[model samples]
Target chain A: MARVQANGVDHHVQVLPAKGAPLGTAVFVHGAFIDSLASFYFTLGPQFAEAGIDAVLYDLRGHGRSERPPTGYTLQDFTADLDALLDALRIEEPVHLVGNSFGGTIALDYAVHHPERAATVTVVESGPATQDWAHTMAGALDQATEQLPPEEALDWFVAEYGAIASTRQGDGRHDAHIRRLGRNAGKFIATTTIARDIPDGRVLSDGEVRQIRCPVLLINGSEGLVAEQTAWLAELLPGTQVRVVAGQKHSVLVEAAEEVGALALDFVITEADKAAALEASLDAALEGGRTR
Target chain B: MKAVKATQTPPIPDEAQVLAEISEMIMSVLGDYAPPEGDAAITLDSRFGDDLEMESIDLVTLSGRLAEWYGPEVNFAEYLASLELDEIIELTVGRLVSYVARSLRTAATAAAER
Candidate 1:
C-alpha cells in the first residue's frame, strides 16, 4: 500500500501517476463500514490517471492500513483528515472529489465548508449527512448489533458481502475486501463507537447545500437507498444534476464500475480545470537537468 | 541561468539486463508469497496488478528501486503521474523498458543541445 501520513495519521493511499500530460487531480473517498479505498483503487482510479490526471484513493481512518486510534469518526474529523491530506501532499490547487456512500457525505460537507478548494463534486449513491441518515445508520447498526458479537456477524459478512466482493474481483479471488476487513474484523464488528459518533442527522442543512459553488454530478439507481435524500439535495443546489445509472442501487459503485469510470472520465475532461493541470504538467516535464 | 543540454545517446542498461534486474527486484519485493512469474508471455503489455499481484508496499519499494536504476531522466513516478489508472494496470515491464530507452535518448539529445 502507498502510505501517506495525513493529519498525523497513516492513510493507505494509492497514488496513480498521470499517463499523458497531467490534467487535474481526482481524489476518491470511500464509504464507511465494510467499504475501503480498495474499491476505487482496482476499479476506476487508474482510468483517471491514464487520462493524464492525478488519482488518489485512501483508506479512511480505522478502515484499512491507517492507524485506527479508537476515536475521531465524526464528519468534522473526516473532513479535517481530507484537509490535512491535501495539505500533507502539497496539493495547493482545487481538485475534483468523487465519493461513494458515507464518503460522499464527507465530500459534500467538505465542498460546502471549503468551496474554494473544490472544483467539482461527483457523488455515487450518496446524500448529504443528514439527521435522517444518522438515524437510519444508527437504527441499522442497532438492528445488526442485536445480531452482533463479531464472530457470527463476521461469518455472515464473509458469507454475504464477501461473496459480493469476490464476484467483483471476478474469478474465485476472496482477498481484497476480506483481507482488509479481516484485519479489522474484530475491532469493526465489536465496537459501536463509530456508529454512535455518526453525528445526528442533517449534518448539512438545505441552505448549506445552496452555498456550494462547484458543479455536482449525483449518480444513483432509480431506487438508490438514498433516493429520498437526493431529491432534497437536488432542490437545494443550483449546479446539482442527477444521473441515474440503470439497474443499479446503492451498490452502484461496485456493480457499475465501468460505467462510473467512463462518466468520471468525461466529467474530468470536460471540466475547465483540465487546462490548468495540463499547463503545469507540461512545465514539469520540460524542466530538466535536476541531478539524480 | 544558462542551461547545458545533452545531444548524444546516453548509455542505458540492456533491455534483457534491465528486465532481469526488475524481475529480481519484484521477487525480493513479493518475497515468498508472490504468485507464479508470467514467463515468455510476460511482454510489453503485462501490468503490476493483473499480471503481477504483489502487495501494494512492494510496488512502492519497486518504484524506488526503478528510480535508482534508471536515474532522473526516466522517472516511473513522474511518468505515472501523467498516466491513467488503466494504463498503470496495463503497464508491462517491456513497456517500461521501452520508456527508459526513449527517455534516455531524449535526455541525452537535450543535454547535448543545451
Candidate 2:
C-alpha cells in the first residue's frame, strides 16, 4: 500500500506482486459513480497476483481515499492522473490495462493516446465515451440523483442487489460496497462535473478506436445495460476477444468473479507465453545470423 | 464469506475492549473529515460504512492497524477473499470482533500445539 502524489493529488494505491518473479504488470482502473479501488483490490488484483502478474489498484481522483480537486473529472483528467501515477511508480515497460465500466473507457483511451506504453487493454462492461453515452449517462445520473436522496438511493441499491445486514447480500460484499460508494459519492461535486464533462468531451472517435495497436478483450454481461455499446465495440475493434457471462449484468465483476478472474488470468498467461516464445525466437535468429 | 475454522484457542477476547480500540483508530484516521465529530456509539451493529462513517481509505488504514495488532496469523487476505466486495463494505464491528476472536483463538491453540 502506497500513498502517491500524482497529478497534484494524493492517490491511494495498492500493489500486489506475484509470489515469484512477476510475468508482467497490469493496472486495474475502476469506473465512476459510487466506485472505488476496493472493487478491484479485493477481486482482480489478488487473482492476478496469484497468477504471477504484478497488479496495481488505485483509487481514482475524487473517489475513495484519493484527493479531490473539485474539478478535473473528465476522461482526459483521469488519463492524465493515470499517466502521472504510472510514471510515479517507475513503470517504464508496456503494461496490461484492465478497466471496468468508465474505467474501460479510460483504459482504451490511454492505450490510444500512449500506444507505446500499453501492451494490451482489457475492458469489462466498458462504457465507450461518446456523445450518445454522455447524454445517456447524464440522464441516468440526473434520474438517480433526483429519484432518491443519496441516502435513500444507497438503500435502494442495497435492497435491489440483495439482502442487507448479515443476510445474503452482505454474503457477496455488494451491499457493503454500495454503502461505501453511496456515502463517498455525496461528498464530492466532481461526480456532477464528470457526468457533464465526459459526454461533452466527445471521447473516442472511430479513428481512435481503429488506431489502438494493442490487443483488446471485450467482456460484458448477458443482460448488461451497455449491450449495444458492447456489441459496437466488439464489431468495431478488430480482433477483440469477447466473453459474456450468462444471467449477469453490469456488476459482472462481482457476480462472476471466478469467471472474470479466470479469463483475465488466462489472457495474461497466454500473452506472457507468447512474449516469451517470441523473445526466444528473436534470440535464436540473432544468434544464427551472428554465427553465419 | 466462509470463516477460517478455528483450530485452537487460549481464551475469549474482550469484545468491548477490542471495539473501543477499533473506534479510536477509526476516529484518528477520520479526523477533520467525515463530519469530524460524533457517532460515538461503536456497537456490534454499527457498520463502518454507515454508522462510523468510515471511507474506503479509512478501512484500508484500519486493516493495517488490525493486522499489526492481530498479527499475520489472522490470514486477513484469506478472510477478505472469502467475502464479496459488498460484505467487506457492509461489515459490522461485531463481525470483525468475532473474526479477531476466532483468529486469535486458533493462533493461540496452534502455537501451544507447536
**Top candidate (lDDT):** 2
Task: Tell me the tens digit of each residue's lDDT in model 1 across B71-105.
Answer: 55665655654454446545677877777778767
True contacts kept of 2: 0.27
lDDT of 1 by residue, A105-171 (tens): 9899999999988988989888888777777778766645556665666555555554433333333
Model 1 ranges off by over 4 Å = A155-183, A199-202, A273-292, B1-114
lDDT (Cα, 0-100) at A103 in candidate 1: 87
DockQ of 1: 0.06
- First chain TM-score in every candidate? 0.82, 0.88
Task: Please report, as a residue range, the 10-residue window in candidate 2 chain A with the lowest summed lDDT.
Answer: A161-170
CA-lDDT, candidates in order: 0.71, 0.74
Q: Considering only N, C-alpha and C atoms within 3 Å, which residue pairs clash in candidate 2?
A: A172-B84, A173-B84, A173-B85, A173-B86, A173-B87, A174-B86, A176-B86, A176-B89, A176-B90, B8-B105
- Which one is best on DockQ? 2
Candidate 1 - CAPRI tier?
incorrect
